[model samples]
Target chain A: MSPQDNQSTSVAASTTPTASESASARKVSRTEVRGRVWKQLPLLLGLVVLWGVLWGQFSWLNILTGFLVAIAVTRVLYLPPADISGRLNLWYSLVFIAHFIADVTVASFTVAFQALNPRPIPTSSVIAVQLRTRSDFVMTLDAIAMSLVPGSIVVEVDRERAILYFHTFDTTTAAAVEAMRAKVLVVEARIVRAIGSKDDLARIYETEATR
Target chain B: MILDSILDILTGVFLLLGGFLSVAAGVGLIRFPDAIARLHATTKPQILGLAFILLAIALQERQVSTILLLIFLLIFQMITAPVSAHMIARAGYRGGIIAPRSLLVDELEQAIDAAPEFDDTERASE
Candidate 1:
């Protein structure tokens, strides 16, 4: 769903969009609904895997029951079908994962050191990064990755505009804020390359061309 | 025998690092000025610390079931921590617990003001 084009405008408005109800209330276009199971394959598989993991068993009995329970849960609770790009890039995915871990490691040390230092932090900033993709999955993953990278907390997301507002530490200057914004965009770019849809890739190109 | 000793030492190092990072988060929580800043302290190091400890656990046990559970735990933490962090930050900002003056830049406030739907940050400012 294009956050900017979302019909949730009539609902309560804030820097962040109100959480859509049960996720069921959100609109799903016909194009997004390729086929029932085809669209939901990932969700069902995730649930099954989650079930098996919870049980800590990979036995055949566990698989059968997990699949059954997954079907039941999906049937019982309506969730918005995630918009998947249907493309998987293993190399890019590995790159994202590796870099993400390294980021967490390095940034954690930096922030931890700052915390332990006697000197007080002067200021922080709330900066917005307009993401290239409006895909919910990509946006969610991007937000998660950025938040995990330390020094930044996702304060608000303007779902309608595909904008993410981050409250970050040590960004007292406009240039520092700009750097933070660029950092978030790079994270978004990494996500888009990993599993982003065709439209998302195209939008990234458009952004590059425009810049 | 030598590899076993090295692995044991590595596990010990991971555990020590994990503990140190967690302590750092605690120190950060006490030191940071406000809720948003404290959030960075609480979440950032805490997650990586947990990851380190979990890795230590996996290394020590080297059991399939143990490792799988750890993996699930890590995945869930990665997914959920950001969400809760976001919610806390959002509440702090909207409730105006996060002092407006402490912030060097607030692009969100302008956007909130620009929206046609709602009225007033007077309650927020107060």
Candidate 2:
């Protein structure tokens, strides 16, 4: 048999391994030693650059102390793991950067407009919006983006019902609220597609009505 | 004198951008639609913007230890911000502070119940 056939045969045979061996194999595949190194490279590079800059003034002992302190802080704070898959997509970061710039610019203008206007900006109201994206990360990003837009804030999120309550400085009608909601959803969809798994995205938008 | 002037200008620009981002995050915290969203506004920019400011300070001071401490602060903020946000959101959910129409799935409630019950109320109070 060819090497491929032989490998397949070995894999098939290994599948029926006794419990202990199976557990070991399971760990091997899931741990994926190569993937971890690749995934951690960016963070490690950042650390190295930071260390190099510090090494000029600090003794070895001080450097060690600094590292220990950083690690302790990291442990206490418990930063969530970056989406490994998302980081691989170069376009994801670009899109997020673009979105952030646009959001900040528009928000600045809106805030300025409100400040310049003497009146209470007509009316303010809270509107209920249904979210299409489900991933916590995507949802969080969406909310951050919307809230940064000067006149709106996310007051509540109902994960069970997939709804959000947004307070707006100028909610005139249902249609206007809906238009804003649609804009938020569109931005979220772009972000989700750029940075999340297709399966996660689908599950996020999944509803009896939308499905 | 020219070098000093350039350094001063660079420092000023970094500080300005950092302050702008921080303000944006504050606005977002007050304006977003829900607890989950507000968490993003409160956390992400706080880390990123603060990191930039710290970096600018380090550059201005040009001290190794100061730079290291600032880096430590950045890492700490990055790690803690999300956890704090998560805790606040969970509390908001339990308290019925969240709206009913925005969520489509909730895996957290099950996880929260199944996990060991510490006095969450006391935790929140603290």
Candidate 3:
């Protein structure tokens, strides 16, 4: 084994047990606690808005109740601090939404046509797509987007290689499989551009363009 | 008057198409051979059907509050549906309920064999 590898392993072995034990009972400095709450502010606001919508009233009374409910829920639920890069490109977000809407419409028609067709169902495949993005947010977004479209659903996610195993309908050829893989990468690029850090956005697009 | 009639007709079309797609999804669920195909039936059309229904509702009730609620319903459904499907697919895969013949690629099986975390779960199923 390499010297660096041995050193890292030793460090891991030494810290793991104590680190895990402290994870649950760890005390935060006041400044760190305040920082966490500040980071969660957007989430709290979003919950309040959701509460108002659920009640079908955006009136002052509803807003007040929603705020109280949101605070109560946040306090009870131990939510980790959000890792928001806070780099949002409005243009990219709009484009992504437009693309998503188009995909949804296309998917609806495709599935509907397949369901209503007189011919026998073609064989489907469980295809492995190796994704480029390793970020948890990107992977989750891709999974949700692909799964919601109907012709495919993510059966397994191998986080190590960032591969998604999809149960896909009517993928008969290697070319088709590659096309699906490309489409996912394209979607990831769009997502990274929309909300990811500027460096992430540039790197994804740059790498995708090269491919 | 003409505009109102046109809106009504559009609403009717949306609702009709939505209902048709939903029925098609139901048929797919029954006719599809295995677990994965059945999941495709459950998720795809249902969200669009719900969207169409919400559109119809929004058209009928032009109140801002009602529209907001409908929009929220759509957003929540879009978020929750895929998550539930993922969970079910994972369970079905781990439990070995999904047929081998039905699967074309078995990368996940290979992944589990390589990964240590799934060892206990995979063995327990056996």
Candidate 4:
């Protein structure tokens, strides 16, 4: 008998009560694997290059250790199933990085200036920030980035209301709070466009602008 | 005297930059209107700032173990920062935080709609 037929027959024998042959015929296909691999090639290539660079200095034993470490890292940092969005363009990602770099530099100077000043830092307050992006990943990345900066922390989130309570060291007035919110929203919108579904972005624009 | 002065100056420079970045991130967190924007400000500077501080320490002490530990700490922070950010963002979404103006779409709404409803009683308790 042919290998294909033999394998099919074994698969059939494993399940008897139901019509296993027909089910097997429909279940797995070679074409599906090829399509998945085709879609994932870029991601795979990136991973391989990254791994090689990170492990380049290691000996064979050290390579093995690194491999284990990589695996552990993956397990610990396993992200939620990404909502694959057709709209995520490479250009958007580049722009997001560029904008982020600018923000970082600006913020660094702002904080340093504050530190140099002798006046007592103003009393802090939690400002409620409303978001527009619908993608969980983009929003989360933004929040994390905000929390890492100086003089502020994300204290609480009212997800239902789509509002974030941000603790600030210098909460002077409602206008100041609003200005901060606007800046964050603009960046979040850019990030969402970079990494989120086009449909998601549309909804956000529609809801936020109209409201 | 000159060499020692140079080393002291270098250390001071690193400390200043690191401290500035850390404070900037904190201020951005408080100042930025939304979580995502705040996160953008926070992650990059915090990593850069901490790296600077650690480098200064390594230079000052010039010890092998301290350097190794510093390297380990930097790696740990780099990995954890993004992962934690991802998690909190996801949780924020499941919890229902809306994006601000400028976003153009809403794929999450579809997912939330498609998701099967649990007992209303459970939701109310939350």
Q: Which stretches of candidate 4 lie over 4 Å from their true place?
A: A1-47, A57-80, A158-161, A207-211, B1-46, B51-126
**Which candidate number maximizes TM-score?**
1
> Model 2: what is its DockQ?
0.12
How displaced is residue A142 in candidate 4, in Å? 1.9
Candidate 2 regions with alpha-carbon error over 4 angstroms: A1-84, A160-162, A200-211, B1-126
Which is better, 3 or 4, measured by DockQ? Answer: 3
For candidate 1, list the clashing residue pairs, or say none. A3-A160, A4-A160
TM-scores for every predicted model: 0.87, 0.49, 0.85, 0.52
Model 4, B1-126: lDDT tens digits are 897778888999999889877887677667654565455456657777987898899878876556666776776785477556545554554454524232222333433345436223324434
Instruction: Report the C-alpha lDDT of model 3 over A104-163, residue by residue, as the tens digit.
Output: 888887877777787777566667777666565677787788888767787766655678
Ten residues in sequence with the least summed lDDT for candidate 4 chain B: B98-107
TM-score of 1: 0.87
- Expressed as tens digits, the lDDT of each residue in B2-82 for candidate 1 is 988888999999999999999999999999999889999989899999999999999889988788889989998998898
Note the Cα lDDT for every prediction shown. 0.82, 0.56, 0.74, 0.57
Q: Residue A128: error of model 3 in Å?
A: 2.6
CA lDDT of A115 in candidate 1? 93
Error of 4 at A68 (Å): 10
Which stretch of 10 consecutive residues in model 1 chain A shows the poorest summed lDDT?
Answer: A9-18
DockQ list for all candidates: 0.58, 0.12, 0.42, 0.11
lDDT of 4 at B85: 57
Clashes of each: 2, 20, 0, 45
Give the true-structure RMSD of model 2: 12.5
